[model samples]
Target: METFLGIDYPTLWFLVVGGLFSGYAILDGFDFGAGAWHLFFKKEESRRIALNAVGPVWDGNEVWLVIGGGALFAGFPVMYASMFSAMYIPFILFLLFIILRAVSIEFRSKEEMLWWRKMWDISYSVSSIMLAFLLGVVLGNVLQGIPLGENFEYQGGPLLEFLNPYAIMVGLTTLALFMTHGAIYLLMKTEGRLFAKLTILVKRGIIFFVVIFGITTIYTLIYIPHLSDTFREDPVMFAVPLATFLCIANVPRLAMKHRYKLAFLFSALSMSFMLMLIAIELYPVLLISTIDPQYSITVYNAASSEKSLGIMLNIVAIGAPLVLAYTVFVYSTFKGKVKMDETSY
Candidate 1:
């Protein structure tokens, strides 16, 4: 077992994969959140402003998703194969929505007809909402455990079985969280009446997220006891959740103080913390097998060869910083309120 800073290659790759996805969730999350609020703005000008708020960086943000998916496939091919196969339907739907979203964003303002714009607006919003929800549903199912039979094969009943109550709840919670996150982003990128409207929307979004989050938390505690086991075993692990709560609480507080920049920062932090909690809970095990615990895909069983991981880690060491630098440069270049020029989306 090769080690990197006292952590084995498999565990180190696990952290790498997790970090990539966490970056995806934080970056693309606001895009989905912003798109989800498309139809909420009634006027054409307002809608365009909202659309343009994310227009500059939305595609760049999706780079994280691409990198994250590639990392997963490279780092843990077995777990990737098993999870993708089991959740094939949802992933297909996710792909469909992703295409629809990109199309809507690119083509919505190309035509002068009101009907055409309305059609794309609806497509964009619905696709955005579903995309966010599906991400959560997948996460919930992963947390809940899938039916893996012999040889890490999926033995789940049917496609619709993925839509269990817990998964749906998690999906809705994800949607709410994204909507709130998007609203805060909008606040930073708008002014005057649109800004005032977003302030109200942000408040409502916060309440919506907090309520759904509370219900989801209660349900997880009551129904999925395994998620909390790690915290119970080590009292210090409780600090993560506590910090997550504080970060979440700070979003609204900063928003109320008209400090949307910090609000957005905290929103991104809260998301990072939540994913961290998930990683802590599911360490070692990449995908749990409900059919037989022994068949579960774990870090050790699912990872690629140590040599491959070491080589990739070296590549990532060079590539990741470049990607991060590019991302920072893009955002810094397009910082502040969106101005609708002729080329605007």
Candidate 2:
């Protein structure tokens, strides 16, 4: 119940950051997921509809990620430094995909050429694939811990350390989640034949996602024993993921009814639950000390000084709503079924 700027700082920070990330995921996850299924459409026209539904909104959605980064740097500088330094290679690749995906989306539409469109489609799919993988890797490294040494520095090591068996497995699971998310998004945002096809794909994806996610959960328990304590301690923590999965599990029924919003909401719930689980596992440790647990960076270790955090609290309160309001305005104005016959692509 600590207060900052005449308001509770910790609560506000968590609420703001959580809301921003959750909002971003709920909105953009589908688009990212939908684009991830780019390879599914052999025909350019069908792909166009899927692309159009997300194109207007995808880049804007990612602004939340940028905002999250800014907040971390400003309010959680130690976590930022440690994470960026340790995960430098993956982060760079992730950015490259983001930039390429954004550029390809715009450039592909300018030309009516089939090859250009196909290239962009591949770029989008490739970028989407990498995006999901990088996300899981980031989460895995954070929760699972990376190589840190004396005084909490990212003691660079062989690339293999980052690509350990568990890390790779987690990457695969994340890719599956994004694929399902993209498929569900397509079902929600588009209509006609494209929507029907997307609906089927998403429905099918649910089963696979469930099995993969289950296996990953078990593996995570065994692979990263340190994380199990958090999950074991709180029975309710498991409910978030279950609730999210239940939404995905029932997406088939919802999709057939053309309940696009609910479908997407469920898809978002699934992803969010998984993310929450990760955060729970990482709880107090913002940056773990690989050399010694004594040198770890918890919220207390990585968070800014009380006074500085107080100042940041005021700044975030002002900035967050403006971003969310604009984002919502853009989406609401753009909402509804996407038609390929229209000026799409």
Candidate number achieving the greatest TM-score relative to the actual structure: 1
The per-model lDDT (C-alpha) reads: 0.94, 0.75
- Report backbone clashes per prediction: 0, 2
- Candidate 2 segments exceeding 4 Å error: 1-15, 234-248, 252-258, 341-343
Q: Can you write out model 1's per-residue Cα lDDT over 51-95, one digit (the tens) per residue?
A: 998888999999999999999999999999999999999999999
TM value for model 1? 0.99
Model 2, 1-345: lDDT tens digits are: 368566556445655566667766666666667777889887777887878888788878888888887877776787788888888888998889989988878888888887887888899888888887787777667767776776578886886467766677788777787777778667667777777787678766766677777897798778778876875778877776667667667665676677767766776776676666666666667767667787777676677777777788778778878887898799888877785555677
Off by over 4 Å in 1: none
Superposition error at 96 for model 2 (Å): 0.8
TM-score of each: 0.99, 0.90
